[model samples]
Target: MKALVELANKAREVSGVRIYKRNVEAVLSAVLKSGDFWEIVDMSSLPVPAASGIVKVLIDEGILFIDDEENIKLTQKGFDFVRELGIETFEDHSCKACEGRGIPFYANIELYREFLQLTKDRPKAIRDYDQGSVTPETTISRVLFMDSRGDLRNKDIIVLGAEDDLTGLAIALTRKAKSVLVIDIDKRLIDFDNQIFKELGIDNARAMVWDLRNPLPEDILGNFDVFVSDPPETLPAFRAFIGRGIATLREEGGVGYFGLTLRDSSVFRWRDFQISLTSEFGVAITDIVQNFNHYITWDYHSETKAAELAPVKREPKTIWYKSAWYRIEALPGFKRWNEPISDDVFYLDEEGSTT
Candidate 1:
């Protein structure tokens, strides 16, 4: 009885795999459908206490045996026992966000070191901002604003992801835009923006709480003359936005001032991911800039340092650290062709690896 319970527990972990009473009618129904068999596990990986309990229970019940190869497999009687209980197995779950790619979160995780270094002595820089964080993309936006081409006396503009310097863009653009629409995920931050705009007499800007992860509403798409965002650097999040942003732009060929960071070591791998976006979506790369001296900072705790240190000058790193900025234009047939002469591409393809 103890062994029976233990076996049932394992099946429950896998989807479509469960232990239930076998009614003759249901058993017949199951027979017509696909079924999963047993799963193998490394005994060494399991906790000693749990493994001992399971092994003892199975051995006492005479349903498990170790073969000549020293691997455990269920016996005929064990299979029969499980079948009587209507036990089933199933395939592992795949992440819909990553499309079964295991490293869906790696891009953000790789930025962890940069975040640490940025906030090492300057905690306030991140905290002063609404999202309490400063990303490489935000820094890039600041850099672009310093080098923007056109006048903004009455331009129509939209700013997405008002977490860091993007918020500043919204506020700055509102001063000149005929109408400024700001979309952000945090309602509190949106409210804060509204209050600040009112206090500053920057009433041209309107704020709405929005999530970039969700599908952009039809009413909002293709409505802005200029769409701006410091989109998430993570690939899935980035992919989702590029397509949405391209659809949101006006056909007169509006500018999209977007920024993102590639890991110091994962530049080639990142370019590969970026190429996937351009191929999948019709976004063209305008200018790719590298900020080797400035690091992307975060604000999980303090903000003063984040705000102060952000503008202050910094020394460049010797190696192993970089903040890259990309200026992308939303246009049809945008292609970023990797140079065949690049040794990085050659090494990646030949070595069959990713950082």
Candidate 2:
């Protein structure tokens, strides 16, 4: 038991990624519950790399071992360690039907099919922009959910930060919103979205390129009823995407939809961000749905740190990356900052593995 705590402390000191004692406890509990490598990571908030690093640490120290089937299993020392830690069993607490997403994946079944077909030839996600698109189900569900919350219908919406998921296209297809304006740094995505708008005669929607790292254009300030984005989680990225989103709102009661992932963020980081938003921006967090956004594994995943560091060394057979959906509303007297965001680590953080 003392050794396990010491190992976690050492990992915190040495691993480039954040490693709390809870991370060690989570991996150990996940191992007890499932032998499959992915199941172990999925059972926790950890990204694949973070989970793998903990498992590898334990394996090297003889607390865990790979079984004959190439599955991860605890050794005698591992069993003893878990017993001493008083974690005799592990149980998954997420909703079984929605897979803990808090909403049915097929909430908007018809739109999903159309959006899927509409985006079949869309631009591939490029690392130059740190792009990774969400599943079609997620995109439609997000729009529908916003409408349910009275934020979508007839509202002029701006999709800033990143449009790689084609959320702007999905929003335009609904014809529920008055207008959709998409702004991103990636020209290919902007071109792809504009072409879709033209072919379908979607006069209500338009896409353009604008790097979010700089201040937004003066002409576009305070020009929308709502905003949506799936942005990078670094503090500066949050300011660029979320701060700018709040500023775009023409008046109070305007809503914003965005996704945040645990893969690149820890609870401590999340707490700091929440404090910043509520205290400085004067917004209310109306909703947070866990694992609501599922990312279809990208083509370049095998070359990423997650793949290289995984102890099992196998390809993912199913969707693995996910994010939480957050809905924020601009309350009366809400504050907004339109200044440029400057941070060298805007795209990557110590807890980050996917970017």
Candidate 3:
């Protein structure tokens, strides 16, 4: 039942709806008490699109049904599933750490705080808009999330791109990992990360300048246990970054973490990427955490001429963009060792040209 609830929660997250677990539980409870399994409930009654996604998952698992009227009905299997869940008497409990906010509390808060302080003076985003950095807290959360997945300790981790130094530094400061490597196209970011490591007396992490357009360096190929990236939202860029990340893995049992947002990439694009990863690259997506990143926006277009400006009323001041974090694993027996590299440009402006 817990596993099912978790899956339902993920489904909700993937639906791009900001909803709480308690609300999802409410929807399930309502469905169960509506008296008849054959009766249709209004889809609009669900708190978010994730409820709709859960229904779809249930239907796919042979536990629910969608009738001709587009109404949701329960199958016999669904009844048994629900009965096992004991939904009627189920009680939703809030997380004590995040106060039901879903953010996990770190065991060593002081260390995390220190790490944030160290990275406070990191470089700002370039004029190219090549990088939109997230808060230091968010990066630490990512490290903790990865640790929770049992992917961090004694592992050789690599960051495919390191626009934000907080992530690599957090991993290194923990001193649990064997080593940390950060590769980026931006020389300034690479230099900054290395400088942070040097100043802090951290020995396990190192940064290098490497563009994703070319193949990974031979020395590092198939050397890492895990790869982390926040690639551009475009398909070509995603393919290039993820493909390169996969290529850097140890052929079997290697994992990759990345961030994708619905703001730029749609659900359909996500589905296509998943298929490509699983079918073409032999990488299977294991988990996706929604709203994992809260990026702080900065103005990079102030220098643009008025003739090139879009008809916006004012600059956006609120932090609205969020990313869905993905965890993918390399399967055994097959590998894409000889995949051809493309020379396509990935970072384009809204008008579809390089910024």
TM-score of 2: 0.92
Count of residue pairs whose backbone atoms collide, per candidate:
12, 0, 1
Q: On residues 179-247, what C-alpha lDDT tens digit does candidate 2 reach at each position?
A: 999999999989998998899999999999999989988877888899998888788888889999999
Per-residue lDDT over 1-355 for candidate 3, one digit per residue giving the tens place of the 0 to 100 score = 3456565566655555444455445556656644222111121123223344555555666766756644455688777776776766323364556423255636668767887677677778765535778766677777887888888999999998755535776788888899999888888778888998898788889988887767677888889999899887677777778888888898688999998765444455677888888988888889887666766754553443211321222333445445678899999953544244565557642312112
Candidate 1 segments exceeding 4 Å error: 1-132, 135-147, 151-153, 166-174, 292-296, 299-322, 332-355
Q: For model 3, what is the error of residue 309's alpha carbon versus the real structure, in angstroms, after optimal superposition?
A: 9.3
Clashes in candidate 2: how many?
Answer: 0
Give TM-scores for every candidate, taking all chains together and pairing residue i with residue i. Answer: 0.46, 0.92, 0.67
Could you tell me which 10 consecutive residues in candidate 3 have the lowest summed lDDT? 35-44
Candidate 3 error regions (>4 Å): 1-101, 105-107, 301-311, 337-345, 349-355
Any idea how many clashes model 3 has?
1
* lDDT score for candidate 1 against the true structure: 0.43
lDDT of 3 at 111: 60
Winner by TM-score: 2
Best by lDDT: 2
Each model's RMSD to truth, in Å? Answer: 19.6, 2.2, 11.9
